[model samples]
Target: MPQSAVDSPDLRLTLRVRAMRREARDVLSLELDDPAGGLLPPWEPGAHIDLRFANGVERQYSLCSDPADRTAWRVAILAESPSRGGSRYVHQTLRVGDLVTVSAPINHFALTPAAEYVFVAGGIGITPILPMLAEATRRGIPWRLAYLGSLAERMAFLDLPQLAGGDTLLVRGDLDTRLDLTAWIGSPTEQTGVYACGPERMLDALEQLSLDWPRGALHVERFQAKTFGESQGADTFEVVASRSDLVVSVDRGCSILEMLENAGIGVPSSCLEGVCGTCETAVIDGAPEHRDSILTPDERESNETMMICVSRSLGDRLVLDI
Candidate 1:
């Protein structure tokens, strides 16, 4: 048997916590090791890693380091105690010189190789965008970054402008007072692809603003899940797993994948927020009510697959080939 090229390992780099500092009130910057032998992965600007600790607590954090460095990747973590234990562990327990296993870089938010780029970052969401700013600077891509934060020091990558050589825009003030999304995003040229990553409010605002722009021109990555409550919107949907047929009764708040997982069905998932395409499943028969951000319109129309984590059946009854 031969291995498929896609299944082969990409650039897998062992990153050690070289330094940790308070980037903001709640955010912490973690500098990783470059490895003595120059062992590192080639990554694009918006790539991130699945960091695995000894306790098997793994979380995905966007790489904040410059891609050109090639020696190391930096990630910033905002401690969320109520959620996954990764951030808490990283912030409280993980220290300098501590080693953590990181998967090969994966990119969901990417620069579309346009003539010019506009980057918007809010709060700790600036991690991934920082690298893109660096890339735009290095390539002379005519880029501008609107870094909006409550305070100037809260924004860790202050050196971006110097690195970018005046090709950057740093807007520091209370988001309520300082943020001007329309003026920043609306004024951009049609060819510009707007890239944004930030808190839900900011992303939602950007999403609304994006509605006015041309499709495929606005790219965003959300770090949190939509709180739709436990009530699934649809009644009684059946999902047909390729391995087995399971007709699960879906309440208004119950998602198809949640039903399956509750029934002891194992489906691959991470970030259950629909940002990561880990829980994607094939749709055998049914119109999918897609809630995920990953799928394109063509892919959704094809009706071949659905990200079971957040997506649901469009029709009353969906038969998914799980």
Candidate 2:
């Protein structure tokens, strides 16, 4: 389980962009370092930092640099075509020597201990896997990577010697070669773990393919909002804030976060689309119509938490630990 958002370190560092280089077509990698030459907070393989822009737009990007590098942090951003200003701002407005506010590293997609590992990545998804590969190599754990991209020229970090070895398979969409998901993800064993990060469709396909695999053996990180299945219909629901002794009515079209904000209640949120776990709230009572992609199957089954930004009460009322 992940640590509560409330307990997260209040680390807001203003780091200067030491360098910015194009890793691939439309993808830029930024190396941020402390202006005072201070050591930055430590981060693990799958951890991501929230990049807060001057325009109040915050976006999460995975830490792609080596974890042992305490003096600097690296992140790669792909200029999204129809971006909501986050990626475009980073690509156009951000530059070397510019100071940017960044939150401490958070890991909702943490890498767990395993004997053997198989990593699958698509396009910019390879950012998070880069560090994981480094960790695996350092630990001497057997691992393989299947990196898929639309084109060879647009693939980032392919020139790196670590990814150029035989253990890595570079699959280009423009080419006739296809990645055999079944062959790579064969019958799962308790000792083996599979980690994948990619587009929604790819993650969905992998999720379907790994249905019979051991629980917790397969882990994934999605770059986009997940598609929700048929729900019990968007009926109005009541939410009670246990500590504040407040009750708010949420309309069918309104989200709990929206309603709370309207009532002057503060809730921390990022990527209100439910991909980021920032707005996860404790559920004290009532069944929540889980819509977020951050929670695991077991976590959802436990009904201990819900992403209030996109989730709603399954029943008429929900009791929250807020």
TM-scores, each model vs. reference? 0.80, 0.93
Best by TM-score: 2
Residue-level lDDT of model 2, residues 13-94, one tens digit each, is 8889999989999999999999999999899999988887777678889999999999999999999999889999999898
Off by over 4 Å in 2: 1-9, 164-166
lDDT (10s digit) by residue, model 1, range 1-322: 1111122345335668778888776678888876464658778988877777767676778998878776667899887758478887877788898887777777878777878888888878888888787777677778777777877666676654533543566677844467577986665557887888888888778877777776677788778764444334355566666567666767666666778878777675666677766667887787877788766545778888887877876567777676
Q: What are the candidates' C-alpha RMSDs?
A: 4.8, 3.2
Clashes of 2: 0
Best by lDDT: 2
- Score candidate 2 by lDDT: 0.85
